[model samples]
Target: MLKAKAIRIREPGGPEVLELGEVELSAPGPSQVLVEVAAAGLNRADCLQRRGFYPAPPGVPADVPGLEFAGLVESVGNEVSDWKPGDRVMGIVGGGSMTTRLVTEGAELMSVPAQLSLEEAAAVPEAFLTAYDAVVLQGGLRAGQTVLLHAVASGVGTAGIQIATAVGASSVGTSRSAHKLPRCTGLGLTHAVLVEDGRFADNVLAAVPNGADVILDTIGAAYLSQNIKVIAKQGRLIVIGLMGGVKAELALGALLAKRASIHGSVLRSRSSKEKAELTKSFIDQMLGKLESGELKPIVDEVMEMADVRSAHERMDSNETFGKLVLRW
Candidate 1:
């Protein structure tokens, strides 16, 4: 086992409970690699974990909180032949990413784009992968189709906009902050809707009367009705987060009439094989774009991991336009 410094959640509560401490990391298994973590990205899920609303899955460190990291490969197990020491890689984990070192399956790692720093790379995996999986893969978004993206200024939101544009699909993004919409539009958003009172169907309809072919929603229950109202025929509503609330009455009649479908997706709880497959698919389809600057990681700010409390506070307050990345 290797002794490593990590961010430990002392108890379920606010950011105050988070503390930088030491933990033990087992040596890489036959198919694993040990990474010297340079940085990690903060996600809303991390906040939920800190509050005790979300717990790490079995086999993950229960007290550590982080979903993604970018770093250098320190060592690889004997059975790992693809990566060598010092390779720059980034990927998602179930937990324990906010640490000085991480041990993850070698197949789950993607090469960091040469143009991006590790800090910037830290912001990519969770956001881009989630958006790609929901908006493109599962949603089956095609060229000339339309996608509705909520929380346009968020990490996944920004990524969705770019991915939609890259695929020749139109994107209508919604945001609570008017100021953030302009930046989202600059990121290739076709239409911007300012959500009010948990409403956006009217504005989305005005922009695309046929309704959106794909709806990537982060806000749960609160947007269910509006989502149903604005879905096009055979539309796909991909729900990746439940920030608003968990329970809501579903408009089954309306959904049935449109012949649409809803999918609930989460990356953290997926099996290692599933994650590896997703990583491989993403690399094959999107890595070139990342390397060529066609797809970029939108980072709101980079801060020292020691100030993780402030990072969580800012995220909870919805003060960031994109990702909040932390480095050791």
Candidate 2:
């Protein structure tokens, strides 16, 4: 076993509870690869996990709170052949990715695009993978369709905008901060709505008279009613986060009239087999766009791994526009 420094939460509380500490690592098993992590990406989920509100899925380290990493392959199990020592890669994990090293299934790792640095690659996996899975796979976003993304300045929202554009769809996005809307236009956002007083239904309908064909909602209860208001007939709404709150009142009549569908998704709880399939699909469909610079990682800042508490503070403040990356 090797000893490595990592961000560990001693007790559930606040950002102050996170601290740098040592962890023991085990050798990779068959079908796994050991990676020397170069950087890790921060997510709002990390904050939820730190507060003990969201626990890591079974089999992942309960104390470590990271979901994505980019690094070089340190070693591979006897059965692995797709990657070798010195290969640069990035991927998502249930937990433990905040450490300096981790063991993950070989199939979960994707070769880092030649144009991106390890820090940039670290920001891609969770944000882009989650957005792609929700908007394309579940929401069935297609060419020429209109997609409405809540929290457009977030890591996943930024990725969703680019993904929709890459697939020939038009996108409309909303954020509490008005300034964030301009930053989204360059990513192919057709319309930007600055939500006021927790209301944006009228603006969304005004921007796309036909209404959004797909709605990628990150805010839960607070926006559920508005989402139902602006969704088009036969629209699909994919809820990927619950930052606002979990419980919400639904209008069954509105849902029935629109014939809309709502799907709640969480990436960290998926089975290993499901994650592998999603990873493969992402690599096949989105890797080329990343390589060609059509889709790029939006990194708001890169902090040292030791400053995990500060990272968490920034995310909690909702002041960050994109991914907050942590370098080891």
lDDT scores for all predictions?
A: 0.96, 0.94
Which candidate wins on TM-score?
A: 1
RMSD (Å) per prediction = 0.6, 0.8
- Which digits, one per residue and each the tens of the lDDT, describe model 2 over residues 107-183? 99999999899999999999999999999999999998999999999999999999999999999999999888899
Task: List model 1 lDDT by residue over 72-144, tens digit each.
Answer: 9999999999999999999999999999999999999999999999999999999999999999899999899
Q: Show the lowest summed lDDT stretch of 10 residues, model 2.
A: 179-188
| lDDT value, candidate 2, whole model | 0.94
Off by over 4 Å in 1: none
Query: Which structure among the candidates has the greatest lDDT?
Result: 1
User: TM-scores across all candidates?
Assistant: 0.99, 0.99
For candidate 1, what is the TM-score? 0.99
TM-score of candidate 2 against the unseen true structure: 0.99
